[model samples]
Structure formats: C-alpha cells, structure tokens
Target: MEKIKISKDEVTHVAHLARLEFGEAETEKFTAQLNGILRYMDKLNEVDTNGVEPVTHAIARKNAFREDAVNASLPPEASLANAPESRGGCFLVPKVIE
Candidate 1:
C-alpha cells in the first residue's frame, strides 16, 4: 500500500486557509491523524470490489409513508395558551435579523 505523508507546513497552510489557528502540539496531532486516515483509505483502494455493487445505504429500503389526512387544529387561544408572548393571535419574538 502507498504511504501517506502529511507535513507540518501543509497542515499549517490548510489551517490558515480554514481561518483556524492551532498550537504546535495540536497541529502535530492533527497532522498525524490526517496521515493515518489517508493511509487507511489508500489501503482500502487495494480491495477487490469487482462484483460488489455500489449502494447508497447498506440495507435495501422503500419509502414507508402514511396517507395524508386533514384534521381539525386547535383554536388560536388554545394554541398560544402556553406561549411566553403573543399578540394578534400570533407568537411574538424578538427581531433577529437587521
């Protein structure tokens, strides 16, 4: 299997691009972890998958859905009974966006 090499400089460059700053120890730790993961992926590339079919999920699945039905909803007063704040039959929340 081919070996994966992750240099400290390369890791630092990636961290810079991601706007992340890491200590020397953390950078070294991430470098080693990334190299290990790449090496494992390279090993996986050596597997024989000639007859194996690619699947989105491990198990076969079919959509299991129930028929939609109309139902009566609670009255506005009842629905907002437990709300912290309400006005004009609607929940009132602080403005979020400028």
Candidate 2:
C-alpha cells in the first residue's frame, strides 16, 4: 500500500472546518486514521472491474408487493379495544410542544 502523508496544518484546517478543537494527541491520532483510510481507498482503486456490470446492490432483489384490493374494514369499537384511553372514537394523549 502507498504511504499517504497527512500534515498537521491539513488536520488543523479540517478540524477548524468541522468546528472541532483537537489537542496534540487527538490531532496525531486523527491524522494517522485519515491517512490509513486514504491508503485503503487507494488500494481499492487499484482493483480491476473491467467486465463487471455496475449495480445498485450486490444481491438481486425485487419489490414484493401484494395485490392492492379493497377489503372489509374493522369496526371502530373493535379497533380501539386495546387503547388505554379513548374519547369519541379518538385516542387521548398528553399535549406535546408549545
């Protein structure tokens, strides 16, 4: 793998852009991590994918949707049977947000 260099100034600039204040130890750690990721990406770039067809997903999957058919509806009382509290066929809940 090609050795990718990350300068302190670059790390500092990135930190500033991200609104992050990093100590010396954190800066060095992040610099190493970023370089390592770049090196890995470079290694991936070397891969040959000449004949392979690009696809959204690795596995072939189709949308399995059931036939849309109107059916008999449940009664309001039966539907609201498990509700903790109900008023005039509506659920009662504490008010949220101002």
The best candidate in terms of TM-score: 1
Q: Tell me how candidate 2 scores on lDDT.
A: 0.85
lDDT of 2 at 21: 87
lDDT of residue 11 for candidate 2: 93
Q: Best by lDDT, which number?
A: 1
Q: Tell me the tens digit of each residue's lDDT in model 2 across 34-84.
A: 998777777766789989888987887799677899888999999889999
Q: What's the lDDT of the predicted structure labeled candidate 1?
A: 0.89
Worst 10 residues of 2 by lDDT: 1-10
User: What is the Å distance of residue 55 in model 2 from its true position?
Assistant: 9.2
* Model 1 CA lDDT for position 69: 89
Q: Give the Å error, residue 50, model 2.
A: 9.8
- What tens-digit string does per-residue lDDT give for candidate 1 at 52-88? 9989888877997767987789989999999999999
Clashes per candidate, residues 3 or more apart or on different chains:
0, 0
